[model samples]
Target chain A: MRIAFIIIAIVFVALTIAFTILPMGTIALIPVALAFLFSFFAFFKSKERKRIFSKWLMFFVFVLFLVIVAKDVFVKDKVVTDQKFQLEKQNSQQEAQKELEELEGLK
Target chain B: MKKILTIGVFLSFIRICTGQISPNETLIFDGSYELSGMMTNIAQVTMQTSVMKTTNKSYLHLSAEVATFNKWDSFFKIRDLYESYVDPGTLKPSLYKRNVYEGGYTKTEKYSYNPAGNSIKSESKRKNNPVVKNTVSIQPGAVDVITLIYKLRSANLSGLKAGQSIPYIIVFDEKQLRVNLKMLGKEIVSAGNLGKRECYKLSISANTNKLKGADKNLIWLTTDSKHIPCLIKFSIPVGVGQLSLLKTAGI
Candidate 1:
């Protein structure tokens, strides 16, 4: 039972990390909650010698939870203008205009 | 009276078949992605329309620009542009171009329409690749995706019944793709900054496999005359993508 709890906790922790890095908003909370629940249960069920790792896993999940909250509160979405893209769009328009002028029928 | 009614129905059918075009307008959408049971902002997409005049005639120029947020750029940067020039009166595409810069991959496709022969001359160029040229035949009034979207707004859809679908021929990747836009009735949806709007819910499907799942790609267009696309949801190979109306001009 303890091994199963630890394995599930590990999976949740990995998911939490990946989602947090993906910056997928507050979605990491799902894995964070699962990781906390399983890790807490595993910590209680484990022997004293094995308790250290479970405690660390719970702590990591807590840290990830804080990171997700912080990112949600802080991150601002902005589209940085790419000058090269703009230049290309302008050049494309010019070239298209020239080509359109050369086309046989438009009337 | 019966003759007048028949004429009215016929005109409405023609209007639905051939959509009108607004001279100029712009729409901005906040594109987001759904993953891990949460939706997150992914990019900003802006669609603008204007008139382009040449020595011979005037055309309605449509352009859509997509740029990923600075925060998401590191993971997967996307800077894409799609442009189409269509007849101002009929909304039939005269030329279309797509320039895509997603992550490390870049490609450009240009199609020049020949309405007389009902064919398109296509040119495709990719990064570090030779330009490929081909000619593909198409039915009359076939258009690119951008023009099709605009046409949807201007079309007289009152004659359409629920589950009724209209087929459209789209030019993409130097090939003609059969796309179906199905009416799915109406619903009131929250359209971000646009607030609660009564919309004509519709589903879009294509023969290509790029769009996954049936009924997964949905669009909510406002029922008003402007017919603004308030919210759009599409399923991509990676995941579900959504775009909500953020701002608008001349709607």
Candidate 2:
């Protein structure tokens, strides 16, 4: 059916997009493909006219784009252990400095 | 799948080695503990065999044939002896007297120490001095012999506390064997008469830069404050043999 063809085409496009993204992008794309499939199934079974089905497909495409963006925002975990470690060590150094200052006063 | 399983098994073994013994006390090593879990052929090897040993805290004194292993391509095969020990408990060794009568030459070493097994000092001689070559010296400041009278502070059969790696390297003469060591963790180990005991252990391997291409000794010492060597193992290119602690008790 024409609707089935659209669903398959959308899934292929989503998978192609996943390859260029992060390690987990392949997983993030699954929901988007499913959403496209659901809309296609709805369009085929609906008594509504072609124009109405077109609107539903458009809505799903928009939802898919949002998911991809949300994934990119949440999955990044850029971490700098070196900088954090230095900051922690700084706190200890400050304590040692205070101890030394007190010792100097005693002298 | 295979690699994952191997990693899992290795991790669990580490846990087993660490989880059973608590260091009631710790043996202090100034720079780092020396001697390794892996075998090292000394100037002499003493082969010990015992006929009788109690299950509780007891001691076994036996005589063994000391040996050396020849090596090729990092693999070791037992070779002719460089030196051998008679009584490891005493330094005045009963040497394997050499003779040329049978077109063969064999010699034994001398020395003896504690047979108590409850302390590092009591364990068999790590340094079997056959040639007794000038009590060879090296760093962190060396002297021929360094002896300590170790006291066993505590003993129990609890799974590893926060920090007890079974079969850990307790102590060594950096001046003698001259090898760097490390603590891997603990495990359920068999003792002479104690049936089985969970022990903290330490292991040592030759650092590539330290010594190259020798594979006869794989020393796995227990991690007790006593620094008991529950297992001293050696792998020949074709085979391996082990001296495991059967039972250990307070001295």
Candidate 3:
């Protein structure tokens, strides 16, 4: 029984490091797999307090990672295109009105 | 402690991901919206832009006094016909890059006019220096030569208002100003790193006689007053680029 527990702990350590270090968008999936594994193990070993502890811990980590990944994906992407020539066009027309009014009033 | 820290990091990431709130809901009338945006067909540079909308007209304006002054050498290296400077009278293309005063005024404006207000004139200029891409390009307001442009008039920015797309062919001051512009409908676009925003994306096109792609202009204006142009993609064979409005104007 102790050997089985030791192997599980070793696997957990390996998985945790992979989850943290893989980089890119895939890191988000780590906690979820960890959570599922822990939860499945707890279902089979319901009487063990260690199983409950691991299960809850892994689930919490999963939720947190999911949030982080979603944040990165949803950030805004935008740019500016200055409309100088357009402004010149519109304003020049308005300026023409003022110029014409000035000329007419002068007359 | 390790588990706690790991969870904490992920939680922080989530906060960042979901923190993108929409633009604020205040100030939702009908006028142009300015965005903290920039474009670079040359290199990675940001420019300021403004987009305006009325019942019958819409337009975008973009400019970077710094970019116009500091010509990118890398950009010149790529394009064959596109050099930093060219001969004025002959319009001959040349790679001769000239340095000018590094700053000047940048302005953009759009308006609605009756048919009687067609001719464009009455230009003001900076006393000594001018805002020319090249010193030899042309003096600001020197000849009062009106260049080519596309016209826009629309309601709610979902493409040009129904029945308002004119193949605008006008002869003003002996210059043939012809344009073919069409709107590309509405889209939900991101305005900032904050969140997604719904906007009307208008495609701008300018036909060229003096220049290759002088008749194209693209702009994205918010249907609402978050008043942001979520995205604007212009064109070139002339000089243009893509720009997006802020996704989160605190809305």
Candidate 4:
């Protein structure tokens, strides 16, 4: 049971870290909760020699939770124009106008 | 007999109304995605209509632009443009053009309609590929995606009963796709920046692989005379995305 708890805690922590890196930091809370629960159980039940590892794992999850919250609250998304795309759009409109003229002649 | 008369009276009282696309009208919407009750904005979409004068005639020019937010560009960039030139009275498309760039892929397509022959001359090009041209036969009233959206807005949908579907043939990617628009009734929905609006809730399904599930895609149009599209929820290959109206002008 102790081994199972450790494995689950590691998996959830890994998922939380990945979500933090991705744009899905808001969803990382699910894995954060699971990691906290398993890490708490593992820390209490482990022997004194192994308790150090569990304590570090718990600390890492807590820091990650704080980071996710900070990022979500502070980050703002903005849109920037691509000059190449804008130029291409201009050329397309010019060509399309010519095509429209030709099509009207056909009609 | 009384039931039939009652139904007729109710339908007449509904006062089916139609709208027209006025020149210089513009609508802007913010597209986002919801995951686990959290909303993440993805893109900004703009739709505008104007009059374009050719050598001999003037046509209705409809254009739409969809661009991903700068922050999301590093992950997946989308810069899409769709333009359609249609007859002002009929809303039948004369020319349709699409220039789309998603991530690293790029493609451009143009379809010119000939009413005399009931056919479309198509030219499509992809990145690092030669342009291909072909002629495809179409029905009398076949329209393109951009024109279809405008036509739907101008359509008198009040006659349709709840759950009734209207099928449309649209030209996209050099093929004619059958898209069904179903009436799902009316409800008050939240329109971003506009607050709550009484809207006509409708569902859309297409006979294409891109649309994942039936009845999953929804569109809400204001029930007022403008009939402006206030909110839209669509299913993408990855997940569901939503577009909420942000602003409008010259309605």
* Candidate 2 CAPRI-style tier: incorrect
Query: In candidate 3, what are the lDDT values of residues A40-71, reduced to their tens digit?
Result: 55445556755655565556556656654664
**Which portions of model 3 miss their true places by more than 4 Å?**
A1-107, B1-176, B209-217, B225-227, B238-240, B246-251
Kindly list the per-residue Cα lDDT of model 1 for residues B1-251, writing each as its tens digit.
99999999877765654344456778899999887567889899999988888778888889999999997889889999999987676677878999999998999999988867389889998997999998888887778889889888877666778999988887777767899999999999987667899999999999998899989999998887678898999998989989999887765
Better of 1 and 4 by DockQ: 1
Q: Relative to the unseen true structure, what is the C-alpha lDDT of residue B146 in candidate 2, on a scale of 0 to 100?
A: 16
**A39-88: candidate 2 lDDT, tens digit per residue:** 66656665666647545565756665576767556654221223432453
User: What docking class should model 1 receive?
Assistant: acceptable
Model 2: how many Å of interface RMSD?
28.2
Candidate 1 vs candidate 4: the lDDT winner is 1
DockQ pick, better of 2 and 3? 3
lDDT of each: 0.86, 0.35, 0.36, 0.85
Off by over 4 Å in 1: A1-15, A46-60, A104-107, B1-21
Report the lDDT tens digits of candidate 3 across residue range B1-251.
99999999877654442232121221111111122132322322232223322233332322222232112231221111001111122111111111122223322211212123333221222335453221122212111111111112112234356324435443322234454445556678766663676666555443554333532465666666333545556554544455443223223
DockQ of the candidate models in sequence: 0.48, 0.01, 0.01, 0.42
lDDT of 4 at A44: 86
Weakest ten-residue segment in model 4 chain B by summed lDDT: B11-20
Stretches of candidate 4 off by over 4 Å are A1-4, A47-56, B1-20, B33-40, B236-238
For candidate 4, give the lDDT of residue B97.
90
Q: Pick the candidate with the highest lDDT.
A: 1
Error of 1 at A12 (Å): 4.4
Q: Evaluated with DockQ, which candidate comes out highest?
A: 1
* Residue B183 lDDT in candidate 2: 41
lDDT of 4 by residue, B1-251 (tens): 99999998766543331145677898888888877776778889989998888777778889999998887788999999999988776677888999989998989999989966379999999998999999999887888989988888887777878999888998777778999999999999877667899999889998898887888899998877667899998887978888889888877
